[model samples]
Target: MHTRDPHGCCYLLYSAVVPESRPAIPRPMERKILIEAGHRCAIPTCRATPVEIAHIDPWAKVLEHRPENLIALCPTCHTRYDRHEIDRQSMLAYKRQLQQLQNDSGHPTQPLIKSPYMISTLVIVDEHGIQVPNPFKLSEGSHNFECMATYVDGSSASYDPYWTCPLLDRRGKFILWAVLGRQRRSSVAISASMKHERYTELACWVFPPDGSERPPFNPCSAIGFDYSYFDSPTDE
Candidate 1:
């Protein structure tokens, strides 16, 4: 059978029976698929989580773990695809759409890592509950923070005088744990694992810096960035 790689189309070989126990997918490749899906179901409308990496072409047919043939799906969505409720064309479209988004976010495609690094980057798809992840703590100091769900790379988003707290999406997903410094003067240092990496282009709330009363939404606007690249944080 045939499949498409990032460069172009390629071919896959079929096996009569699916391996009862396929080797655990290599961690780096698994991470690639997770990042591509923004760690959620690839279905644009049903982007539920906790996600599972799935084969676009059934493993029973292809009999190999190729990055091009993989996608991320929630339990329900995975079941739907397996049951043929979701078609191959639609699934391929989802992969293409997300890859385009990551490229548009400015990172382009990166090579898999021998080691993973964490940094301060986030994407808030919906505003609701706020939470923080571990390797994080607050001492006594200020921090400069930005709302990067829409305007990653530091927009003129409002951050008030001073605040330090965890932030979660409305879906209760742990998107980020922000201990932001005061607005305008983002000079507060923060503490987080420098190895954590995050990127997403999903549109959320990124208030304008101009102090405008209303900011129209732009669905295509990019989100998240390597905050450490510019706003490297420090401990109090």
Candidate 2:
């Protein structure tokens, strides 16, 4: 019988076996992936935040955590991909879209104004009271139209109006007032006038109640009208 040292035998067996575990993504790399995806789900339509770091290629096959091979996906999307509801090609496409959006650096794009009850347009106003055209159409009506002001460091005050009045002019102008809200924040008075039976002319004025000096420009002002409302019913 051959006598064997148990410790030496175990060491030799351990050294002969190859490690099969995949490497985990570093914290820094994970953060970079999340940031590149705008902290939102990689799927453009999902927009869910607090995403998970997912591998484009299965770690079982690639065993790498490179940025190009990683993406940020919501738990739902990740599960969908794992379950084969979404194919690998779609996952890679979403990742590419996110990368392309990130490459458009310098001056971030503003969020588009959306409404569920009314069709409307948006105009951006600067600090010098200069109005810039940002025409958009909304299919719904909403009580509030909140957006980032160009002149303000943070998000500007919510553009919620307390009163809405329909003007008697043929131009179809409506006036909105925000006087009953909190103090310090300026009250916005808006007059949205329709023109040429197609477009709208919006005039926004800001009034500060605290006796403070007002900025030379208005940040965001928008005016739009639905042309469908003006369409006459035709006979079949």
Candidate 3:
């Protein structure tokens, strides 16, 4: 999975699987796709320039291979989509507007339309739930951990070690956690020796604070770090 970069354009390199099957996109293909998508924001009445390819369906649900599944969008729209912030009304409006534009412009009938990129830079928090710079710059790579156990309360057993919290995707604010796999060899060793059993890696997500409608970015989430070149948090 690829998170929208600060500029809203994310190259699906590390996010790609079976490179031989799809291969990396060529420059011409990328340019053509961007140009055809209107080179503006896809959101209704939003005129921001598009910077990234926003997936109509959440990447977590389906790996979209066709350009039809992707739309060139600004970082703002991309972030909102990533956070699942677009409400039903806004979604419906976007669909209607895009349809009208396509019919008027004689464009091919497809689900996604291109637009200028516009994204918002977010301040990420740390394990203590304190705001911090984008730690992604400091981390080496992305990691994915699976649930090895479950709880009587029905909560899954997956836990993140970097932030001392469990995995949770609260709203759009992604709970940024460190991939405490091989990177945290010393920490993992200490935790393992203390428990004397094979333990999983440490990870974290977001949790909505009391009375706060929105889930604040975990203290360890991207805050001050720059996203000039970065990948999404995922199990690769």
Candidate 4:
């Protein structure tokens, strides 16, 4: 169950290499990791890049790319992580710090809603085939029945999204939403759709109360959040 590195470090090697082909992290999810670390290594001391996403929990066991379990790290830090030089608790702490940083820096006015714990973006690639890698905050109202989302561009006002169809897990805990929004002063409405040649499936990430994680029900159901323009906006 334990493998020792040459430096006498021990790690759970059995849960290391995934036997089957591992699934890829959604583009949006991966971008979330990079953005958290400012596109550098998540290690506080070594903030170097090009960065790669590291699974806080081993992929071999979890087999899911849940955002809670992913982090951005440079190649060296990644190697150190794989070699057990870095540990899980540290990674988890890093995630907590980064999330707090994002919240403090982006939205100074905190929501008065009970479901304020949620901080995720629901991305659906538009018909035009482009998406924004940046994540805009989605502020929820009571019961999350109706909500407004804000997407910021370098110039102009924030894009407002009137979101609905929040997807819940078996426990009736809402984890994802079907979103609709448009750029400031735009006429057209935009929505996200995933149509495969065979079938389209929907699932939600289940977050445990204990800050633990479960692998996603459908690992391949991952779709990215898009901040890019849906269609060329008409000049106001």
Could you estimate the TM-score for every candidate?
A: 0.37, 0.39, 0.30, 0.37
Mind giving the per-residue lDDT tens digits that candidate 4 earns over 1-236?
88899999989855555367886888888888888889987665456779899888888778888988888888887887787765666666666766656775556643322211221232322333233222421222111111222111111112223222334567967543332211112112333423211112221221222233321111111222332233335488
Better of 2 and 4 by lDDT: 2
TM-score between candidate 2 and the true structure: 0.39
* lDDT ranking, best first: 1, 2, 4, 3
lDDT of 1 by residue, 113-167 (tens): 1110111123322122232222223233332233322122122222212222335
Better structure of 1 and 3 per TM-score = 1
For model 1 the local lDDT of residue 194 reads 47
Error of 1 at 5 (Å): 50
In lDDT terms, how accurate is model 2?
A: 0.50
Candidate number achieving the greatest lDDT relative to the actual structure: 1
78-152 per-residue lDDT for model 2 (tens digits): 887777766777677666656656666674654422211111222334334345334433232322233223211
Candidate 3 accuracy as lDDT: 0.40
lDDT of 1: 0.51
Identify the runs in model 3 with alpha carbons over 4 angstroms from their true place. Answer: 1-33, 88-96, 104-236
Question: What's model 3's lDDT at 133?
Answer: 35
Query: What count of clashes does model 4 give?
Result: 4
Q: Which digits, one per residue and each the tens of the lDDT, describe model 3 over residues 1-236? A: 56677898976646445423434445675565466556766653454774676657655556444554556667876787677765534444454444445564556644332211111111223334333332333233432222121221122322332322222454634343322322211122112222232222233223222223332122222222333333345576
Best by TM-score: 2
RMSD, each candidate, Å? 20.0, 17.9, 23.7, 20.5
User: Where's the lowest-lDDT run of ten residues in candidate 2?
Assistant: 113-122
